[model samples]
Target: MPDMRVVLARELGYCSGIRRAIDAAETALRSEGTVAATDTLLHNAGEMNRLGSIGLRSVELLSDEELGAATVLLPAHGSTLSEHLGRIASARAVWDLTCPIVNRAHDAVSRFADAGVPIVVVGDKEHRETRYLMEAAGSQLLRVVTSEQDLDTLEISVSRVGVVYQTTQSREFRQLVLAWFRRRGIEVAEEMTLCPEVLRRQDGAVALARRCTAMLVLGDSSSANTRRLVAVAVSACPRTYLIGDAAVLPEVGLNCVDIVGVVSGTSCPQTTIDEVVAGLRQVCPDVRVEVDAWPESVL
Candidate 1:
């Protein structure tokens, strides 16, 4: 077997928002003996398992009985459910770990709703973040567009509409939605709510994927940002693979590849990235792994 070279994407591992939520969960668990979240803290299963091992309890919805005098941590994607918020208020302590970026999107939706303008959300309809925005928009939510087909099916009753997007939505998709609105002569009140860290990771993945023989995207499949990374990488490098961790490296058939690129989702932990690199080395004994420098903001 020939020696292989592995290059890592510049922006890999947990983004600022996920890191903050995890830190808050840990801090609450240490001080309060137990911490509970209304939903999974993040999309990564491995991180969720790690937190669960340390007194982090996840519930689909907060109940007054279960939350009695317990500390509650909100998910990073934010929630607009009044019932959930009301239940959380009764807790002994509440840590709102909603990412600042997500909060901004919520605010944008509220503003549009207040103005009686129909809101068009550009994102996955089933994603928690998109659901939050849709609920925030209430009766004012005009449509949720996940694809060009959705836009084609859209029937806008108003000449002007407000647009907000899921924080983890792809930039290209947002652009497509915006352009669709423009083609129909609809005035758009747009809020660019995509996460900066996610954008950086997507850009880095595309760059690395173009040059590598195969690409590996590391993160849970359920994560929207992680799945977007895989989609973007595949468009540039068709041989892209989405793996939860290094355990699946053997199944990926990387032995014949001379160059491989690695990129991770925002919720992924650095330890997972390290494990993938180590696994690559084991697969190709003479593999040379190179990691890009981390941005100071992430450091």
Candidate 2:
């Protein structure tokens, strides 16, 4: 086996929004003994399981009885159901944990819709954030563009369109959508809604991946930001793997690589990143590990 070195990205793990949500969940769990969310609070499974063990519950939709009796926590990703705002008003208690950034995106879309501008949302149509944006735009929402194919099939009757992004989308994708609008001589009122912490992690992952022989992206498979990190890393280093936990490290053939890079999604826990580092050390006993220093402010 080759001598190995592991480099950990500086901006790995939980963003402020996710931290705020998790903290709120724990607080609610302690005070009320049970708290419910309309959906999984965040994209990470491990964190959800940890919270679940302590009385955090997720429901597809809260019933009137559940709403009347339980403390309901709005998800960090925000919600599409505007009617829920009315229902939540009558709940026992409500915690609106929507990220400030997401709220800003919502405000931007609402302003565009109020101004009678046709809106184009550039993100996964099925994503909760995208759905929220669409709901904010209402009938002014033209369509959602997830790929170049979506843009190719797009038929815009208007000369000017307002653009909004899912908070976790990549800058590259944003640029692609903007460039498409530019080429067509369409005026764009672009709202910069991408989460800064997510972009920082992506930047860190790509930088490390460019120099390493293999890259490991740590986060739940269902996490959109985590999947984006994997995609960006794979573009820089072909031997990139997305693992939910440390147990998958041995199967990833890190022993063959001289240099390995590790990065995690914003929703990932710090403990998971530590476990991955420990797992790397176990795989290559003489491995040298280096971790970058994180910034003081991420917002």
Candidate 1, residues 188-289: lDDT per residue as tens digits? Answer: 999888887788888788878888889999999989999999999999999899999899999988874568998999999999999998899889888877
CA deviation > 4 Å runs, candidate 2: 60-67, 82-90, 293-299
Give per-model TM-scores.
Answer: 0.93, 0.93
lDDT of 2 by residue, 1-299 (tens): 56688888877778999999999888889885447887789999899899889888764465677767889888898876764756666778778889999999999999999999999988888888888888999999999998889988988879999999888998788888989889999999988988887888877787788888898999999899999999888999999999899998878876745788888888899899889888888888788888855443344
Q: Alpha carbon lDDT of residue 74, candidate 2?
A: 85
lDDT of 2 at 286: 83
**Distance from true location, Cα of 248 in model 1, Å:** 0.5
Score residue 42 of candidate 2 by CA lDDT: 93
Judge candidate 1 against the unseen true structure and give its global Cα lDDT, from 0 to 1: 0.86
Off by over 4 Å in 1: 59-66, 292-299
